[model samples]
Target: MTETRKQLLQELAAKNGTPLFVVDHEVLRNNFKEFREKLPDVQPYFAVKANSNPEIIKTMFDLGSSFDVASIYEFKLIYKNIETWPDKERQDFIWDKIIYANTIKPFKVLTKLNPYKILVTFDNIEELKKIKQRAPDVGLILRIRVPNTGSMVELSSKFGAHPGEAVDLIAEAIGMGLDVEGISFHVGSQCNNFDNYLQGLNFTHSILKEVALRNFEIGFTDKEGKKKKVLDIGGGFPVKYTPDVKSFSALAKKLNLEIKRLFGKDNIQVIAEPGRFMVATACTLVTKIIGKSIRDGKTCYYLDDGVYHTFSGQVYDHQHYPLHAFKDGELKLCATFGPTCDAFDTISLADELPEDLQIDDLLYAENIGAYTLASATDFNGFPVAKVAHINRENI
Candidate 1:
């Protein structure tokens, strides 16, 4: 961490109290800009499920971001934000700035979302039937299953259809009188293996050609009625949470080369659903030791936040945050536990912590902005960590 970032985190903790999330808009803007610069032809739709703090959303909106929403609650949040702007300024966002990326949704939610005419994703025939019954007017994107070989979270188990089934699903949607506008797939979250994406792209190319050969009018069309296929390579773009992971620029270069080789660069309109990459490195979680003791001959510390709070990513996303202790002393092995009553609320099973650390001593975690707080709960009546936005205008 930079001295400036450390100072900001200390100041935020002093003012907002411990167990706070310090978000820097400058980092957020730089991350987004970096992705766009490397992949010039791709449109990035910020995935709202990563971190739904209104401040983050506002910063992204000001930078002309489109969104990837997964639920009715997320939809309402983005819709209401766009509603706050003037009509002329909001037209860009209202028309085509969002995609409902969830493959499964309740019938009532689908019915309620029909009037918006937003784009949505589905992976099966049953989902197509539900959409046909409730919201046939909306644009449809088929979600296909791809390999999650090196991803921390393998989404294929819960989402996506096999490529063999995608053609039939799209045909069924077309037969039901729905607008089949695109195809999508996730390489999984926190995926470092680029081969997963390469395989997915190859499959997508084959499917597009197959659709074309069959004379199926899939995907959106231009004014001249030319088919404009939307290729949504869903987000899993990893960040530098650890030294071993590949950098975004390196991954982008490889991806750019593959895209050019396969589709001749920008032949098909491309989009990405980036959730963790956009905000993962932008926010730091600051927590303080509330109690301490020796357990099994190792120093054990209890913190104000844990599994039901900001560190929820450990249990949910299989992530281990990089921890930094502020106190100065010889290092000792320590186990950090959360404030929750559950024993599973362990934050770190083993950490190299300062030996002189005591109650109220501050410790921080880096690159925790993504899946951390988004799924946090009030279990044991512990409140969620407060968020403080910094470096806004500097962006």
Candidate 2:
């Protein structure tokens, strides 16, 4: 941990008080650089689902990350406050850059925004039929939703077709003359086992091969560093919020090797929609020691950060982020909870808190950028955490 980051968070806490989030802009840029350095062959479209803050998005855009919109709402959010919002400029806006509307079942509002360069994902022939009727002018990228090899905590058993059927779906789309540009897949979020990643890339490459064999005009290569005229890997380069989760960079290398072996070369222009990894560690939420308790011989630090407002789906995903006390001395076991009403809004296990904690004490958690703010709600009518941006200069 950079001393400056620690001090900045402390300073932000001092400046904004409890229930606040501080984002390190430099960490985000470094993350993008590291991922690109490792997979320099592929272009990264910053998955905005992780952090929708205009500041963070502007930082990412300034770092040269492309846009990967999963929904129209996310697209709006990305451009809402940014100076480069596409149509707001009002001139042949669809030609600006590649913005993929990567979600299934887009509404008419979504189609109305800009369907020219907007890529839609078709899971089945039904959605295919709907796209033809709903948004006739749009090109489509089929989202090949692969199931959890039971390797991930949650399964996307709800989305996409089996690998065997994905080929036929792509073929059907081609037969319909739907503007099929490229293919995509989601290696289950928070995946630990590397084999799960290998399987997803294999599936996508297979479909791409089928598309190639069909003599489709789809691009398989661009002048390296140029726009990928090929396939995309959605569902991110996985980041380990938990200490025990596998390394995302290692998995990327492994998948890159598999991709080379399959293609006999690494020329495919790949687009990765990485949300969790890029931003998960770029931000941390800080709260005041509004309250504390001693229960079952353990110190419970109840900060003002609401669990629903901070980490809504974290526990359900079995993420074990590092917990730390403010004083930063000897670590001890203690329970940590939020100031929510249900009494179930705890962010950590009962064993994570320190032993010497006291009333009005401060604490911090790490690897908290991804789902922390996006899922926040005013449920208990609690005011959400305030935010502060940190730059590399400070670090």
Candidate 3:
């Protein structure tokens, strides 16, 4: 926590809105710089799908961060904002090169899109043919095995090509004159082990090395084996959402070295599409205590923000939110709950908190900027969470 976070929490409590998404721009900037420094030459592509707050995206831009977006709407968001820049001196916004990470892309979307703007991914052979038929001139990186191996945060569904299928897909795409540039995968979200990156990158290298033997000689179509263009290993860089999250700086350092070691340091540019690390700690959810109780030797605090709207209920990782004890001052044990009528709208199931909790008292839950907002919806007419950008940097 920084001085800005402390002051902002105090202010957010007084500010109107029960369930609010308050972002700390300064905190976000620090995280952004950390990614830039650690990855060195890697294009730190901020995943907008994780936390699509334009304000935070602007903060990233100020810190010289590139982005990794999914949909055309997301890519359009970048274009919408880019209009504000001085056209006389154009800035190189990476939106032009945002990866279209959706494993199953539609032919309609591909045909309508300017080919160079999207780095399309395909899992099935039909999808690759669709890309070929619709936009054959485009560059693509086959999304390899949907990792049952990555972070257990959001269960990455089996959406990409199977282990042995990636090379085949690449070969077919090249036969269609499509540029099969590289490969990518997700180890997990909120990934605890930085070595997971090395594992993923090394795995991608192994796969690419195999693709090199495809006999679809680039610069000479009849020849076999060719040098690859890029290796884009998708991101799951962890942020300190809770005390339990182990920092893998040593692991990350080793992974960086390994990436340079295996990928020849200069010819390949690694792309880290970090979502949570970019925006998690940068924002906090300010939810008010709506009700409270005790059962089976445990305390429960029902909050205005529920799992339906926050998705914290479905989160099994037990994300430790830096719960604040204010209004009634001092601290004691209390479990947090959500406002939803569902019996499972529990936020803090057995978490200890200040016994001073009272109705209307505020709890600033740190690291709420990522999946919560992106996955939020109105259940039982519950309104969308009000969002606000707050930080010492902004002040």
**lDDT scores of the candidates, listed in order:** 0.87, 0.68, 0.68
In model 2, what lDDT does residue 80 have? 54
Ranked by lDDT, the better of candidates 1 and 2 is 1
List ranges where model 3 is wrong by over 4 Å. Answer: 1-4, 83-96, 146-150, 154-157, 215-228, 293-299, 311-322, 327-332, 392-395
lDDT by residue (tens digit), candidate 2, 1-395: 67766787788888778777778788898898888888876777777877788888877766767767766677776555443655544233332334554546656754564444456666788887767666765656666666566454554666666767876776777677666667777767766667766777788777767756866655322334353445677654567654676676787788678777876563455777777778888888777666777788677777677567776646544555556666756666776777877788886655465566676666677778887788778788887778887774432
lDDT of 2 at 78: 57
State TM-scores per candidate: 0.95, 0.87, 0.85
Lowest summed lDDT across 10 adjacent residues in model 1 is found at 87-96
Which has the greatest lDDT?
1
Q: Write down the lDDT that model 2 would get.
A: 0.68
- Higher-scoring candidate on TM-score, 2 or 3: 2
Winner on TM-score between 1 and 3 is: 1
CA error at residue 121 for candidate 2, angstroms: 1.3
CA error at residue 198 for candidate 2, angstroms:
2.0
Q: lDDT, candidate 1, residue 367? A: 87
| Tens digits of lDDT, candidate 3, 1-395 | 56666676668657757688787788888887777777676777788888787777777766766677778777666556566766532322432336777777666778865434456666788887787778776567767664445364644566656767667777777777777767777767777766556666766776667766656532211113434355666777777655676774655677777887887743454676788887877777878888877777666787888777765525644455656654444465667766767877666565557775778877776667777878777876888688877664541
